[model samples]
Target: MHAIVIDDSSAMRMILKRIVTSLGFEATLAEHGRDALDKMDAADHRFDVALIDWIMPEMDGLEFIQAVRSDPRYDDVTLMMVSTESDQSKVVRALAAGAHEYLIKPFTPDAVAEKLELLGLLDPERVTAGV
Candidate 1:
């Protein structure tokens, strides 16, 4: 599967990329939401998933989710918010805005696998095998 990792912090992006790559996803990195959108627009193949940070410089994750959902071309992409915003209201807002899943910051690789499994983006056997 192809994935996009969107975060303002390069460190965080790298971390996510590593986890997704280990889970068998080929990932593309983006500094922020706008950069992510540009990358998506320029891609020859559509991404299967997007891991987005909630707060960003040009566009926030919520706005990015909305934009992606609004575009029919991205209809099949699953959006997961990987953010530090753990408040119930923020979570609700993100889900209402079109996020398929939400992962709080400081998550373990297992947590990511669980979320992907819930989204049906990861095979059960893969997570069980600890891949």
Candidate 2:
């Protein structure tokens, strides 16, 4: 499986990339939504999931979700918002905007893994074996 981790913070991107890689995914990092899109378009790769941040320069995660949802090519890709925006309404907005999951920041790797499992992206065997 492959994942695109989009965030303005390099640290956050690295962290997310590490988490997904540990779960058996090839990870790609992006500085923002536009960069993510460009990177996706630049290759023939089909991402299995996208881990996005709500707030960003150029294009935010919400906009990224909308763009991806509108494009048929990304229909099979799961969208997950990994942001510090913990407001109820924000979570609702993200879900309503086509995100498959929303995970607040300051979260552990296990939290991310659990969300991926809930989204049916992670294998139960891997979770069970602590992969």
Candidate 3:
């Protein structure tokens, strides 16, 4: 599976990339939402999933989710918010806006795996194997 990892912090992006790669996804990194969109638009490849940070420059994760969902070409892409925004309202907004899953910052690899499994993005064997 192909995934996009978008965040302003390079460290955070690296961590997310590592986690997703271990889960069997080939990842593309973006500094922010607009950059992510540009990368997606420029490439012929269609991503299977996007892990987005909420408070980013140029565009935020919520807006990115809306933008992706609005485009029919990206309809099949699963969007997951990986943010520090853990408030109930924010979570509600993200889900209502079209994010398939939400993982707050400081998450464990197991948490990510569980979320991916819930999204039907992870292979059962991989999850069972604790990958």
Candidate 1, residues 1-131: lDDT per residue as tens digits? Answer: 99999999999999999999999999999988899999999999999999999999999899999999999999999999999999999999999999999999999999999999999999998898885
What digit string (tens of lDDT, one per residue) describes model 3 on residues 1-131?
Answer: 89999999999999989989999899999999999999999988899999999999999999999999999999999999999998999999999999989999889888889899999999888887886
Worst 10 residues of 3 by lDDT: 122-131
Model 3 residue pairs with clashes:
none
Query: Following a full C-alpha superposition, what root-mean-square deviation does model 1 have from the true structure?
Result: 0.7
Of 1 and 3, the candidate ranking higher by TM-score: 1
Error of 2 at 98 (Å): 0.5
RMSD of each: 0.7, 0.9, 0.8
Model 1: weakest 10-residue lDDT segment is: 122-131
What do the candidate models score in CA lDDT, each in turn? 0.95, 0.93, 0.93
Model 2 over residues 13-113: C-alpha lDDT tens digits? 99898889999999999999999999988868899999999999999999999999999988999999999999999999999999999999899888888
User: What is candidate 1's local distance difference test score?
Assistant: 0.95
Candidate number of the best TM-score: 1
TM-score, structure 1 vs. true: 0.98
